[model samples]
Target: MEPNDQPAPLLEGRFEGRNDFIQLVRDALGVAAQAGWRELILSDSNFYDWPLGERAVIDSLNAWARGGRQLTLLAKSYDEVVRRHPRFVAWRATWGHIIQCRACPNADALDVPSMIWSSDWVMQRLDPVRSVGVAGTEAGRRVAARELLREWIENKSAPGFASTTLGL
Candidate 1:
């Protein structure tokens, strides 16, 4: 078979409302999972709530992690995430090794939006309360987004969550 060089179409949009945003995230995650993504990096303060409320998303994440993919989360405040979404605490307890979390002390400077990125795709949530954001699968966009995430993680001195301290 000949090589296929055409670039994947951009998967971009603005979602309105929590359900829509959740669905958008679900779709994005599903694509990444199906594509056999090796790693996922997420930067969000309130992401715990989304997965806690959406069982399918949680299931998908668990399944993805079980398949040996790494899921890293960089959050502004772990206490806040757990406080708002206690279910996450429980979930993390079960999948702590696979779904690792890090603390970002200077999350404000990295403020484009909350985002989830894999090697092949990127999803960003622009508005926290309104659930408005964009997602794309273009290689350039994914690379740029992934670079931004890497830089943010490196610059902020993000630290991995300690299960002993966090009681996870």
Candidate 2:
């Protein structure tokens, strides 16, 4: 099936604490992979360090990419992420064709929380200061987040992975 470009209304809920956030992201990734989702979009500064630091998460992501899934990451601190998260860096290196990353210079000023979108599902950390976040299959919210991600990618200059020498 082709990816849906239409916006869907967002259904929202909250996750409190690091464990809850990690499980939410893990479950969402599994669902997306099982459903053969074509596109996965993530915007975060340090997601590779906290919740997604596990080896299983990295392996799952690699498997999904190997299955022809496409991933776009709009990261705020790409450099730091690579330095701290070797697993993620290695995964990106191995699946550079399926995964593409862009750096958002205005991420801090935007104060956007980390978000993951797959198919119709979305999980977002609404507050940066707290571990609280909202996750749901609300179509509208997913579309809004996707649009914001698109805007960030378009407006910022691409930090070519080649220049970073991360081999991504």
Candidate 3:
């Protein structure tokens, strides 16, 4: 099924308002668990504005893992600095089950613009592939995503991606 065919799992927004962040995280985790997504890409390069966004994301990831589901978190490597802090160590442990990827080469940060741009590049990449599925293992999906990215670039005239992009 398509990622949208199933509900798009909750991804914490850029801001986390103190206690509200907890609820946001809980909700995101709930959606993820229910969706049974194998990978979850999170972009926190902008979390610099909301100091608590990162923490909330980690907390929500923990809650998602606790539910006994697999999820891959996509973020820049720098965020690991925050994760390595003593304060974040415990939360990290709870998040041990989730996989994280640096979105630099893949999708960059998880903002709307980035996602838009990334999807175009991704759609272009996948356009050439005979088939694709996001429900597969992380490794499998990454490989497929790459293959599609290549196809997307190689064949620019493809019909589905003609739109100039909404502004990712």
Candidate 4:
């Protein structure tokens, strides 16, 4: 390996197709757990198409669910998630202490980027319909991706997506 090569080669660069998107999400979660990344941020309009319910993702998440590590989910709405990602919903309930979910109801759906971000890697779907986007470890691109996610979460969202609800 070159001196600069990452210990684990990432599925880096532009990717197109739904299969690629799902694979990238899975790969990121697996790598994050193995690398002990400090945090992960997932943002989407509604996560209507993400593969968060898969068993492999749950396994990686289970591995990543240790103390002091944080995971945040930002979305215009999680209704789709609740409906589509039942496995993820169950996992979130078990790891609620380390997971934070935010709702961006007022933000335009089109303005919200569909992406997953971590200190070491990021994948963003520039065109959600086609599942086309880019992912990599390029420092400048990672910085920019982090900035965009932070802006939407801090400025346009609020506490939401409770793990449980009480029917009065």
Q: Over the stretch 1-168, how does candidate 3's per-residue lDDT look in tens digits?
A: 345575554332233233443344345444554455444433333223222335554554455565444433223333443534433445545455443323332433432111111221111111112211112224544465545434433332122211122665
Q: Backbone clash tally for model 2?
A: 9
Top candidate (TM-score): 4
Cα-based TM-score, every candidate: 0.76, 0.80, 0.35, 0.92
| Per-residue lDDT of 19 in model 4 | 90
- Ranking of all predicted structures according to TM-score, beginning with the best and ending with the worst: 4, 2, 1, 3
- Which digits, one per residue and each the tens of the lDDT, describe model 1 over residues 69-103? 78788877667666665555666777777776767
Candidate 1: regions farther than 4 A off: 1-11, 109-112, 164-168
> lDDT per prediction?
0.68, 0.69, 0.35, 0.89
lDDT string for model 4 (1-168, tens) is 245545466778899999999888888888888777889999999998888999999998998888589999999999999999999999999999999999988888877889999988889999998999999999998999999988888888999999887898
Tell me the lDDT of model 4 at 86: 96
Off by over 4 Å in 3: 1-27, 33-38, 50-59, 77-89, 103-168
Please give the lDDT score at residue 75 for candidate 2: 73
Give per-residue CA lDDT, model 2, range 1-168, as digits (tens): 236543233335878777777677776666565566789987776555354546877866765775667888877767666667677777777788777777756557336448887767888887645658888877887788877777777776365343226454
Against the true structure, candidate 4 reaches a TM-score of 0.92
Report the number of the highest-lDDT candidate: 4
Candidate 3 worst ten-residue window by lDDT: 119-128
